[model samples]
Target: MSMADRIKTKLTERFHPLLLEVIDDSHRHHGHAGWQEGGETHFRVRIATRDFDGLSRVAQHRAVMSELDDELKERVHALNIEVIPADKA
Candidate 1:
């Protein structure tokens, strides 16, 4: 499966988010550091889950990063995360 698909699956299994979007933003970083020839090196994840309700922004990011640790250690270079607020959800 693609990295995006894998990421989405992981988040779904962990958070059961109200909203989730795992976007492959690799193409936009072409020729930059860690930009591989085939892409899948960077991502933007937008998610909203009750699991993140009381966490600070940094904690929210840490939670998602922890879930995606394997991917980060492998090929993913960057992860831009947006943890949507309850009001937004």
Candidate 2:
């Protein structure tokens, strides 16, 4: 699967998100540091999941970060995540 697809799948499997939106924002960061020819360096993820129901914003982000693990350190240079509870959708 593609990098974006992989990212989406990983998040879905790990968090079972009720809503997930993975946006490739590499084009917006063109010419900036860490920008590459391919559009995989920057991403924005909007996810709503039961796992985030009782978590604070920082905790929600931390959960995602842990799920992303090495992908965040390697392929993903910039990531913006908007995490919310499933009911908030």
Question: Would you list the C-alpha lDDT of every candidate in the order shown?
Answer: 0.95, 0.87
Q: Model 2, 1-89: lDDT tens per residue?
A: 66688789999999888899999999999999878898798999999999787788999998888888878787888889987668887
TM-score of each: 0.97, 0.93
lDDT string for model 1 (1-89, tens) is: 99999999999999999999899999999999999999999999999999998889999999999999999999999999999985688
Off by over 4 Å in 2: none
Clash statistics: count for each candidate: 0, 0
Off by over 4 Å in 1: none
Candidate 1 lDDT (Cα, 0 to 1):
0.95
Question: Against the true structure, candidate 2 has what lDDT?
Answer: 0.87
Best by lDDT: 1
**Cα deviation in Å at residue 68, candidate 2?**
0.7
